[model samples]
Target: MIQYELQQVTQQYNGKTVLNIKKLEIESGKIYGLLGANGAGKTTLFNILSFLEAPASGQVVFAGQSVFFGRTELHKLRRRVVMVDQYPIMFTTTVFKNIEFGLKIRGMTKERRQAVIDEALDMVDLAAYRGASAAELSGGETQRLALARALALSPEVMLCDEPTANVDVENQAVIRALLTRVNLETRCTILFTSHDRLQAAGLADETVVLEKGELVDTSYENIFSCSLESKGKGQKICLLQQKIPFSLPGFVPEAEGRDYRVYLNPDKIKLVQGGQQVQQRRGVLFGTINLMMAEGEKVRLIVNAGVMVTVLLPVDEYAQLRLAIGDAVTLKLKPDAVEWL
Candidate 1:
């Protein structure tokens, strides 16, 4: 198992700053999700952390030791930590031989080598391809082959970059399943990057959002457990040390229909002036504005009532209303906005 700590990691390319992470820590035995928009330094950070590239400054501490530079120490770290690259290499050999490459390099005997190779193949469900040419495999199969090769080494930690990038839908599930099984059955820890939220939601214990190399936020289930769901209650919210309150008009009567489905158009919502619920209660409190825009001639808004409510409004109308960012207005949730959800 390996514990990696990075502080003030920064990188530059062609005079442009590529990454600037202030601090990050990875514990042993946990799967972490690193997500960001394209070109947000995801790959650059990955390269530096995996020891493939150098950082302008800062340090990476692994297992209580600081790794600054030098091939000797870098090679040592490379051997212990394996990265199944997005585009993996395949030597001109059979799949079995490719999987056995690391074992051979590590000087394992023939008996031990075969056992490790077989176990790795079985782990990835690639036993059937043992005799196939490594280069002839499909995109998804290639990724699996890459995993099998990495597994044969039985690394202390594995970093998978875009493992499912070129995979077919069916094979994507296969790869995820294989990765999950390996994480549970083996002692190796995994830190992977994924574009699929649903996949990350299920597989990752913690998801760290990266913006331009810095940690923007980390998602956790309990973060919102205490906040006012409607927040519209505004200053009325109590604090062992907080007080104040803003009264709002009564809730709109439910539209007679199936369930209301107030669609919160992220674009349509604007910060308005006056009657504005306190900034703290901003997320909730929905209402429609008079008239509409290039969009529907009319717009609607609805506030959800949980322990509080979730606010939603139409995009076009919100803009059409010409409402500034802190103004309060009435919400006319249509029959479509509310539902069992």
Candidate 2:
């Protein structure tokens, strides 16, 4: 029932454009990640959503009403959305008061505010530190304070900008688990950016990849499906172009379905140069062997742009060919030679 929509949002900084998001939408109760390298404009998009600054010009609709850059309307909207930044804000006040600041501003009763404060601190495992001074807490403790402060407000939408970046690896896992638990318990729409591949793969149900302010890929299942098939299989094998790319792209369910294996293992391929003109079933590439090392009966060679590859042949075959260093040799492979990664 939650909806946040934007169309053609752009931002400029230092004579250079930093953020350019076109037609983005988020539904409530889902954790969508904004994943990319450094300087990928993740922070800039967060600013746009918070109304700290508006786009050059675009349209935004939150919940059901249209939104503008005016301070009054933005202030009202800000109450429902909270931003927990990378670092916690220090006020030279007690942690208990910091968590209660939002509700106090809205003129809530003291009894209700105290209850909310206790709940927030308990959720972030900072209930014991509720009486501690905000200025004296460590880095990890400060981040939890920021998150607890936001959770105290009970915002409808929460945006965490690299909340675990400064924490240790073990603490990073704990933080991720906390975020996941928060999303499930509260059902608040969540969007976070992370450089951890495994974290993004495991945590986010939707992935939005940005390359220098441009989207390289957007689909969740298909993109990882591509990566699963691309790794370890692109070691120099040719596609038929006829069989795949027309229907399922390397997937041939009709040919064998379950009985036969569609992927071939590259390590099993054996090279033998014989025909003056190569046949259609065989592959041939001529390259000089820069170096050769023996591994029992198998041999490893560097050739064709210094590609390291292995070939297994009998010692008799090696002695017969008399293959040596700097010797010109032709390599052969077939479509069935390589296994799908």
Candidate 3:
């Protein structure tokens, strides 16, 4: 079931357009990862979904009901959809009180309120800290408290905006596990935004990439624009980059333009030590590591050959190789791994 749908949604700020998505459909009971860079209008999109900010011109439909801006009925809808901000705010009170306040406002009975609060605390692994002061908790604990507060409400949809952005690695793992458990057990539809690609791939059932306030294909991660030089046998497309001519088989474009885009999944690229032979019959390119960074349990590496290529591998594999910045490495690209975009 589609829980939320946006049609011709366009949001503006000071007469300047920010988000201009034509259409988007969010499915029910699935964890979705919203990915983008800073200032990519991710937060704005979240606000629109949470009904905190209305679009400049568009329609938002939640659970088959059309939601209009400034409607008193919106408050009722908002109650079913809770949002956890990047930086959670805590009232100057005990953690148990903070989680109980929302339940009290909803007129939950005293017995039920205590039961739900206890369950929420256990869900976040904060049962021992329930009586502690909310303001004195660590960054990770604060985030867990915020999540506990949301969970106490028993919202149907949870919109988390970078829930683990400011937490340490240990806390990040804890939050990720908590989210996964919640989605599986409670069947709550979760939509979360993250700047880390690996985190999205790990936590979300489906991932969407946002660029310049518009939804872009996730394949754009490895897409490269190049002019087609010639066609080889079996309708192979030869790109004009390296003299060795990298050709993709069974892909022929009918268009007349020579310029085209090709996509390669980061996982498809295999990295080998320099001077090592590729085990498979794959196209090999030698390059220097331009940049490398840890993404959760994976390491994302940017290699500079004739063209820049992105590669992802397990952190354990990277550590075993003992690779570092400016290291020379050989990348193996299988013929079937390349796809035309």
Best by lDDT: 3
TM for every model, in the order presented, reads 0.65, 0.64, 0.72
Cand. 1 TM to true fold: 0.65
Candidate 1: tens digits of C-alpha lDDT, residues 214-287: 77653211111121122332322311111122122223223222322122232333424234444534133433
**Candidate 3 lDDT by residue in tens digits, 224-277:** 566655343534444534333454434557664466666677888889977533
RMSD from true fold, candidate 1:
15.1
Question: Cα deviation in Å at residue 109, candidate 2?
Answer: 1.1
Best by TM-score: 3
Model 3: number of clashes?
0
Candidate 2 per-residue C-alpha lDDT over 1-341 given as tens digits, one digit per residue, 9 for 90 to 100: 65688878778887688877787888888987877767778888888777677877678888877888788989988998888887757678999988878889989899999999999888878888989999888888888888889888888888888878898876777778888998999998888777653466557767776656655443211111111222233422232222211112233333221222222222444545433333322244445656565545555554431233345556677777777766666556565554332
List the lowest-lDDT window of 10 residues for candidate 1: 220-229
Off by over 4 Å in 2: 218-341
* Pairs that clash in candidate 3: none
Write down the lDDT that model 1 would get.
0.64
